[model samples]
Target: MQRKKLSHQVRVSTEDSELFRQSVTGARPLMQDKIAPVSKPGKKKARQAVNLSQNEQQLFFFSDGYEGFVSNSASLSYVQPGDDPHLAGRLKRAEFQPQVVLDLHGLTQQQAKTELAGLLAYCQQQQFNCACVIHGKGLGILARKVPNWLIQHPNVRAFHTAPKSWGKHGALLLLLKINQPELALR
Candidate 1:
């Protein structure tokens, strides 16, 4: 490597050097010490098997029973019977922005299910109106399974294939049920 020299060298005059030394005549020397960064360990929650909801548990209960056949490229969508028919349309149009997103790109089916449960549960817990689930991968297995599994979640009001801006065919936009519990009568 070639070193570039300064265009002009700076030289301090003897009078200027004497004035600098006089300015800090009584300064104390600083102690040389190095501090090792200490990071506190976070509280670890108990590691236990994730308990699936009754509807979710049924996924494992049925042996080739039926989840309704869905073609790989078909648009996955649904709105609960009593819900506003337009709710699904809103999702289709990407009107409501997803507040939280869960991506299942690299997860296995079982792992995806557990993570999906957590995402939905969190949405309900936080009373989120919309959430997105991205399941993009080489195969469309997750794309088909996620929507079918969502159809059974009670807290889900409606769901539709996400808009192009939201992952298009590789994702789903969810309209979750907002729960507001009454603390007491004022």
Candidate 2:
């Protein structure tokens, strides 16, 4: 059976319209208290007073300093002059236990650089000689850039690939030089 549908229309009366208008017009805005503006977090003050070039500052702020392919293999060892020969061997053999471990697996380039800088600074302040960084073997971004960053750090003496048990090519063992002035006071 076919049924006819009826449409209903809503209409506002003049009194209701007048009342709504009056209500709207009579309502006052809520009072708002003034709030002090919050200051954004500023860049951390450098531990040392040395001035950095504009390029260097930009490097720290923007990139991890890895421009392109690194020449060395991840397994290759490194030892700076005046450093113990056994240090490289020890790092390769996983001899010196790492007091701190920083993992940069999922971090972006900038984040990894910032964290690496902070960790190295903390390690230096605490007089820690050895630390481990797990950069992973993703697109080789961190693996390549982390080494470059470590090289730029003043306290970093040498760094080498971790052994098989300690993450192999994906991690590095860092040897940090103690701050001479701080050491002299001890």
Candidate 3:
């Protein structure tokens, strides 16, 4: 026995087609103004777009010791050995107020390192328990570098990404080691 192939065609009514067209037209914007044409290319601007000033360039030139580190992930975190196990959780909860805040936005790597070192020194001298560093989530350079720098700093006991209200992944909450005097008092 031989089997025969069957074919079928579907059609829409003229009214249905007209209604669909009208719906699309009605949903479109009524304004028909043409966009202004882009100006013809003129003499090419300088290829090197250096936005940094002399001082900023100097700072960038001084960046050293950050050669081998790469950004691991957006949700990076760290806690020193023997530090409070709950430190990361509390940071996530925003339980502690930042005694000092450093915004490292728009700074080159060296500039940021210098500022961070100064901030840590200041916090250590003042015996601050916590500080917040807002390192924006730009190209992740700072994000990666900050963690590595913090790991090397003697004062940082723990650090983690800030909570939602505290700049989230773009910021870090650092728990500084208590001063010897303060520890003795306790």
Candidate 4:
């Protein structure tokens, strides 16, 4: 035997959507918090590369928002770059290692901006000197946008592609720009 199907008519209106649009239109624009910009016009920006003389103590390796050892406090002194090598080698072989590795692969551009802003803030607050951003190889997803945005942020001291051991070209090593207290210590 075949069963008869019963259906009821449903009514819908755009009232909720219309109200949301109205509210959005009435909302004021968010004011951005201002800060001093790094690498200002005509000012040369400094790169963070540990030289041979800087290898007085072994810098620790930390990642994924966790704290870790600074390796051997004594070996820290030996983590310096010998000479004209690439930036990745310098950072990877530095006495101190980066403390964070932010995975940006799944983030949309808006998400990247928001997360990166938070990461920069965190790096500053925690006195973290270095960070890694895994943006992945440009398969056309984020591509140029992510790297360019990182360079433009004021709190970013330095950023470049990571070495093979440090995540290869899919990641970026980020240096936290030192502020008054941190700068005074250096």
Over 1-186, each residue of candidate 3 has an lDDT whose tens digit, in order, gives 996665765689999999999888848567968898999878877633223343343234333674533446666577777888888778777788899999999999877887777677667667898999999999988887888788766667888888877789899999888776634655
Clashes of each: 0, 0, 0, 10
Q: Please, what are the lDDT tens digits per residue for candidate 2 over residues 71-176?
A: 4554756677677777788777777888999888899987787677767766766778899999999898777788777766666777888877778889989988
Which structure is stronger by lDDT: 2 or 4?
Answer: 2
- 1 against 3, candidate with superior TM-score: 1
Displacement of the residue 36 alpha carbon in candidate 4, Å: 60
Which pairs in model 3 have colliding backbones? none
Q: Which 10-residue span in candidate 2 carries the lowest summed lDDT? A: 49-58
Candidate 1 similarity to native, TM-score: 0.64
For candidate 4, the lDDT comes to 0.56
Candidate 1 lDDT, tens digit per residue, 7-119? 99999999999999999999999987979889999998984444457336434422233486364556777898798999988889888999999889999888787778777
Predicted structure 2, TM vs. truth = 0.59
Q: Compare the candidates by TM-score and give the number of the best one.
A: 1
Worst window of 10 by summed lDDT in candidate 4:
54-63
* Candidate 2 lDDT for residue 134: 94
Q: What RMSD does each model have against the real structure?
A: 8.6, 9.1, 15.9, 20.6
Candidate lDDT values, in order: 0.80, 0.74, 0.76, 0.56
Off by over 4 Å in 4: 1-89, 92-96, 182-186
| Candidate 3: Cα lDDT at 101 | 95
Error of 4 at 76 (Å): 26
lDDT of 4 by residue, 143-180 (tens): 45555555445555455556666776677676666565
Ranking by lDDT: 1, 3, 2, 4
